[model samples]
Target: MAARSRRMTLPSLAGRIDPIYKPATKPTSDPAHSAAFIFLHGLGDDAEGLENIADQFQKNDKVSYMHWVIPNAMEDRDAMTTAWYRPSPLTAFAPSRPELEEEEDEQGLVKSAAYVESLIDACVRKGIPPNRIVLGGFSQGCALSLFTDLTSKKYSGRLAGIVGLCGYLPLAGGSQLQHLRAIAELPPTHGDVPIFLARGKGDSLIPKRIWNITLKGLEAFDASSVEQHEYEGGHTINGPMLRDVCNWLEKVVPKLED
Candidate 1:
């Protein structure tokens, strides 16, 4: 893997940005590209956190290949660390979607979604179609991935898949989100898009009840084309979880040229 530039200026947000880029482990037949994966890190974690994930993929010979791009989260002043959004009040954290909705920082989520769009656009500019790109993240990054995938108007059906790890969907069961879904201009399979969600039943930061609620909410939206998994551990990824993701990628995405 090589670093292309310190920061590539995005058309959407005209400011300094520092994102890490890792090329595919092997070369593809297409001189331009084959596929791409955009992964995001959890709060307080930077692009470096995904380096291990990229390494894991390198060991797998069964899946279609792609270049990996992981972007750093914007800094949050109140948290004194990098975060996709401001942290909700500690007490506001609950199992019910209604309570979760009340405590969420919608504004921050919107901004994070925009940033994600910029990254996706960057991938498109590289001659890769949106449908050939996979969007994924861990924890808070997972929340942002779902928010952007569901809310974005332009990139519908363009994405190959979405992978959420150790996180629950944001704004689940919210009236505003329901309104958006009703009026959303999504592709026919948007509701049926392949979504791989995995959470630890023992996760403390995000309760198991919330994960169940998220699962039901996705189902309520007619997102039947989902692969959900649960582990008996805590808020971290394990070998079994990684294998599941690898297998899903192999099944959902087309293989690169031989």
Candidate 2:
């Protein structure tokens, strides 16, 4: 793919944290020929961390009109790093569903989900309809994106699609059974929105077993809505995985050629 040489203006914000934007490659050609893609970075990472990935999307002719938004996670004061929520410690022993049921584990997710909702609303105010916005993230960001969309009544049908990379749907059971129930009750259109989930089979931080449960739950909800991909890697985004995301985006978002 060629380098992205077009300059993109920073998106306007409304009483919320700002995000780094990969502007539509040809914004001046036609204002209406555009869509917004908002992706969140993984834990310990910031908005700039996904610039290279966003660059790759800018190179695709089919998605050149995408304005990719990468938001920074809230600063983890104790750890002196960024995190949307407290992720299980990186170890060979991934936490079991029961082990992940602590209420403390979900507080940050709730707080972060509010911010994610605000950001999407901000995009809508920018003239992009709710159905034209795509939400996604890597690792912890992926979990946050999924949590916000699945659990919030207001956010359910507001998204065009969801892209989750190397992450699991947290709190799928135990005390948070209400969340699972809410997701089950989502309208038919909610089930129709495309959702792409990719993971590294060898990922150490998140065991394949956990993701398997997530996949099954999603399938049970709407078999046709979820697409799964596994790569030969561990706990990270790779070339093939990104390519899949691009292809999925192309098919999911309508093309508006100049």
Candidate 3:
């Protein structure tokens, strides 16, 4: 096993970012970093709040070779707290979803997606391939990650996988998103990108209706590669879920040398 190192603080761009970056504990390849997982923390949380994932994985040699990028969400002025994007409360599902058209924060969503891409760009600049990178998040972070995978022009269908926990798909029924999805023309690889989504059975924020809707939206997007997990809890993570996430990360971005 490799020795643990201090966490490295990476600057956010344009004064809206500060991410905790952890390099692989053990080098699995010549350059020492074989794969990367960029995770976004939920609303009201910072990168440090989600640093335990790195603490756990770095000690385990199986995935210790992975570089972890955990980022903080910028402040949502409306809510007066940190968030990946502005939170627009979801109204009940109706055909055409006029609420989505009128209330969803389109500008904030696009900007946050770009921030995620910038994180990906940083990893690519470090020499990792797009297919070796996985994007993931919790709550608001999860929502933004899924949206980014669907809408990012350079990486829409090119990431290794996506992990969304305790989250619902945002702007699922909106016309603008529908049009963007159409224009994006997700390559066949988009469907091939594995999506690991887990929800808490007792989660009040994401009721049964919302989960079903999220699933349907993914299906409409032609997401054939997805793994859905259900755990006993509320709008937070549990032990079993974390264990499953570690296992999933191993499978998604495994050792290239092994």
In model 2, the Cα lDDT at residue 4 comes to 32
Q: Which candidate comes out best when scored by lDDT?
A: 3
lDDT of 1: 0.74
Q: Largest TM-score belongs to which candidate? A: 3
Report the C-alpha lDDT of model 2 over 12-122, residue by residue, as the tens digit.
344334577667775636444567888999988887789888876677564876777787776777557788887654434445674454344677788788778777766
The sequence of per-residue lDDT tens digits that candidate 1 reaches over residues 1-258 is 334432333333333246777666664766234677789889888888887888778766534357777888867888899999987532225546543444678789888887788888887877677877889999998888887888787664458899999987887756555555456655433466689999887888878767877787776667777888998898898989998888888766777555
Model 2, residue 189: displacement in angstroms? Answer: 9.5
Q: Is candidate 1 or candidate 2 better by lDDT?
A: 1
* TM-score of every prediction relative to native: 0.85, 0.82, 0.88
Error of 1 at 26 (Å): 1.9
Model 2 residue runs over 4 Å out of place are 1-17, 28-33, 60-62, 89-104, 175-190
